[model samples]
Target: MNVRARPFIPAALAVLIGCTAFTSVQADEVQVAVAANFTAPIQAIASDFEKDTGHKLIAAYGATGQFYTQIKNGAPFEVFLAADDTTPERLEKEGDTVPGSRFTYAIGTLALWSAKEGYIDGTDKALLANQYTHLSIANPKAAPYGLAATQVLAKLDLTDKVKNKIVEGQNITQAYQFVSTGNAELGFVALSQIYKNGKVSDGSAWIVPEAMHDPIRQDAVILKKGENNPAAKALADYLKGPKATAIIKSYGYHL
Candidate 1:
């Protein structure tokens, strides 16, 4: 008949089904972009967060600068934990992060470390002495620890001496790896890398004095993408709480 049957399940019904599918896909999970310097402690924290809140955290660790660029281009991270206050402050100013949700979670320590015993002799001058053929440091533009390393070298007037021998890593984690893997005889790395049970690692290390540079105030911020995400906020708050602070401090981060 010209009346033709049941109107063929309505175009509106099909549109509604498609919209449901889209929403389900969008609601999948929360992601966090973390700075490489804080890798170990954050991994532990993320595990505790997932267990306590029943929320999955997909963490991506890289240089803070790279993560900043990604977030600006809509990489879809709900939270950002940076190696320094500078990038988080910039993101907040750009409105990429939730305003007033930024806070310092921990202060990082810089150390010149060597897998070879007594390679550093507990002095910054070792960098200039050419006691080691290769030295690793994070890229100053991408990682805060790299900036600190530069400052320490400059203060010792060893920047020129060691500049040629320097091998730059994209981030602090890789810098640590360079020394550990023997690609570099020594490198500047976060103190947490070698800390276990409130003790330092077997390798020799010279903990850079705090006066050598501006404090490494590692900050965490809630991304604008996560302004309404309960899980993201919960994780942010937990990081500043006593439990997480204790864990961070145990790993040699200054509270």
Candidate 2:
């Protein structure tokens, strides 16, 4: 008697098929509101996160204050990476964020940056010289980094001296752009914006001393809308992990 031949999947092929199916079933997309200052770091982190977790991040970069307003207005954001800890704490208190999901992801540093090489000299000399006609900063009302800039000016007693030359951008990205494009002689921007691999990536910058302004404790939280989104939770956890922390540090943020 002839036996019917059996169709069999090899063990390795079977495991591969199972993993593919598992990833497909578990993969999910999260909508994230990222602070403008964190744009590059988040982009890098998001890429690694997708590859490692098989989850996707759709990020929208803007001022943390604007993100707060949007979230309050019922925007579809599932996670928030804010420029300050206060905003995320407020969101958590207001029930806009998942309980116990908020944490400081990075400590931001302010920088006085100019597109011209060797222009900043890493001190207050250029700012005090009063030669530059235009100085840029983000809108203090809508960005924490902008507020810090104002604070730095106040501490340096240059608020009135530079008031006439101050050019305000809607957000940190625009502030950096103002200087990067030579529309403004210099700008107050996030160190992470111009930093890479532990140094300024381009242009000249003076890393503002932490004592000049309040500690920029950047925080991350899962929003109420993401309460049940595994991808959001996964991302929150990933930010606290080694890979994301390394990326954040490489961009000059303190974890």
Candidate 3:
């Protein structure tokens, strides 16, 4: 998650950028498979990248697990922006991606959020007493964020106590919806979904401590389909630039 001047210009494109005057890359679209947790910031970054490089991006956002299945079965995505590094690394090992194209783009943060203000009292300590009617979380088996949420509960010794109160979502986006819509009083969700402009937008939340779970090392990789596609490589490169890093940080992610 280091922010550096990485603009994934193809060797041919590099000369074009170095010139004082240059045309952008061809108007080709990159098909990206993105994790649900990154939905907001990636869209913003994609827009900026399109303007700068003239390469459009079409994104499919969902659980990383589902994307893995689709990719293994020949989903035509040129890039995979996973919520965890594990998936991209696996893709590389399985020959689904361009070699040496994988790198962590962002480190994600978790949050315990509620729809109403003043509802969540503190750092999930109140949950030990079973105070809430229902608790929501992404399906741990499918979503890395959900797995991280389970890890936090385990660290706090609340897993067994709240087993029955749990409501699961197919992905992090849906899990956030459960809390945002009052379907569940509270839920564990990616901070990016609830944070903007240096604050939580509409809910009470506790930024889950990093020690509770392993780092959510989100990585991006160019898939085999994009091995020769300049647009796909360029998008992957744009993800490491200052503009993309700034947008990601604004959403409460770290680089």
Candidate 4:
């Protein structure tokens, strides 16, 4: 009897098919609303997270307050990285987040930064001197960093002295932009915006004292939308991992 020859599957093609199947079943994507101050660190951490966990993170960076409003309005965010603890706490109370999912991810450090090298003397004295024509700050109503900046100014008793010279950005990224673009001579920004590897990446900066304002206890939480999303919980856990912690610290944020 004549036997028909069977078609053979190539090893490489078989392996490729297996990987595609595994990825389709095991990999997932999460939608994250990240605080503007956390943009850099999150971007860095996301790369490693994706590589290690086979999950993808899609992040939108903006003011924490603005994000809160968006979330309340039914934004499809699976995770929230707020610049302050209160917003997440409020969301939890309002039943918008997964219960017991809130935790502090990083303690932010505020900084007075100027794109021009040596423009700031790294002290409150530079602020008290009132030498700059324009000073940029994020809108305190929307950004926790802005609120911290205002508190620092109030503690220094320079709020009135600098009122006329103040320029507002909608978020911390824009606040930094105001100074980086030379539109403002200096600005109050997140240290992570200008810091790298334990030093300011460019320009001059004075890291604000923790005593100057309430601690910026940045919190992360899984929103109700993410209650059943495995990728969302994976990312939340990844943020607490050593790799992400190192990236956060390298950006000048306190863990």
Candidate 5:
């Protein structure tokens, strides 16, 4: 006599399995707000973080100051990666971030980049010469990279000469885009924006030395909303780890 085996899964058990899978997928996602200057490295690191930890990162990139305002207004971000230490420190002091979880993740480098090969002529003094009709930089009030650009100009004694020629972008990403699109002859941006895979891009660039300005110490912190989130804490710690540091360094950022 031939016999057939009974179906193993009950209808109720199948529904329970589906619900469990959905909850696991939801739990693995972590929301993050990252400063614009760090966009490249963070995108690279996020992929590695997910591969190694099985946690997904949903990152939003913008000016550090703007993100600070949004977080203050109750944006639901579990982690905040800022372009400078000031904003993260302020958040912690205000109790908006998890106290004691703040740390520097990278040291940012500023660069004056021109999409054309020789537009900047390899020196910043050209700004004083007024050889370029328009220069782009992030808004000093909103972006840390913009603050560094302003310092570079002041140090070169060209602030007066270039002040009126400046065209401001809301964030470093836009500043870079302005130059890339030829809307601005040149622009100040984060080195990471043009540096990748252990080399700088084809654009003309003058890397601003660290001594000329206040250090751009990129800091990362867990928000109060993430105080109890294990995945956010894991990512914050992983960013400080060797693997992540290597990826950051490849993009010309110091850790």
Candidate 6:
């Protein structure tokens, strides 16, 4: 993944230039098509980015596959933050993005989560027991996390037995909601959604081992429509900055 960076700005000169730009230059809002698994951390990054660069970010969150289809049809999005590197690379190859502007923003983790406390345990005996009525997951064809979940199930040889009990969501966010709201007893979701402030937010969870599935390398790219948009490029650069990386890390994603 290659990221195009702007010229460095000295602290004093940057303040002077930024102060003038903040009041004089018209604000440009970068329209971002983001993957649902990155919703929380991206929101935090957007807040800081707006304050730091005096630029606004209008983000649309959903499955990467859906965003890819929309981008192909000219969705008017300036930036794409995909859950996997594959979509962005495909976009670039198809001439949907600015050349050489793709880069990995974060590596995500998948976890098994339940809304009910003590409903799940260290051992995944319940999975084989088939005690849960429904197991929620994002659509495998549309979501990277869902693909990972399927991989884990296959490795455990539980796919055939649990196929009838699966409920697929449009994206990871919706899948998480299914478990969090008890619509499904347990679900496979991104760790960033359930883990926050150094721990899981609710119920019990199993941090799925990386070996269980392929590494989820999330990437962001500036669309060809945003070739001349400063805000779009700025946001992409900010995503690689220390502050933004820290925020993403706090959400349980690996930088």
Q: Each model's C-alpha lDDT?
A: 0.87, 0.94, 0.90, 0.94, 0.89, 0.92
Higher TM-score: candidate 4 or 5?
Answer: 4
Candidate 5 pairs with clashing backbones: none
Q: Per-residue lDDT of 116-226 in model 6, one digit per residue for the tens?
A: 787778456666678888999999999999999999999999999899989999999999988888899999999999898989888988888999899999999999988
Clashing pairs in 1: none
- The candidate 6 region of ten consecutive residues with least summed lDDT is 120-129
lDDT of 6 at 249: 95
Better of 5 and 6 by TM-score: 6
Worst 10 residues of 4 by lDDT: 118-127
Could you give the C-alpha RMSD of every candidate to the true structure, in order shown? Answer: 6.0, 4.3, 10.1, 3.8, 5.4, 8.9
Stretches > 4 Å off in candidate 5: 1-27
lDDT of 3 at 26: 58
| TM of each candidate vs. truth | 0.86, 0.92, 0.89, 0.92, 0.89, 0.90
Candidate 1 Cα misplacement greater than 4 A, ranges: 1-29
Q: Which sequence of candidate numbers ranks them by lDDT, best first?
A: 2, 4, 6, 3, 5, 1
The TM-score between candidate 4 and the true structure equals 0.92
Q: Quick one: how many clashes does candidate 2 have?
A: 0
Clashing residue pairs, backbone N/CA/C < 3 A, model 3: none
Q: lDDT per residue, candidate 2, 1-255, as tens digits?
A: 999998899999999999999988799999999999999999999899999999999999999999999999999999999999999999998889898999999999999999999998989889878899999999999999999999999998999999999999999999999999999999999999999877899989899999999999999999999999899999999999999999999999987
Task: Quantify how close model 5 is to the true structure by its C-alpha RMSD in Å.
Answer: 5.4
Please give the lDDT score for candidate 3: 0.90
lDDT per residue for candidate 3 within 1-255, as digits (tens), equals 987887677987777666625344356789999999999998899889989988899999999999999999999999999999999999899989899999999999999999888887657755665788889999988899999999999988889989999999999999999888888989999999989999988868888989999899999999999988899989988988999999999999988
Compare candidates 1 and 4 on lDDT and give the better one.
4
The CA lDDT at 71 in model 3 is: 92
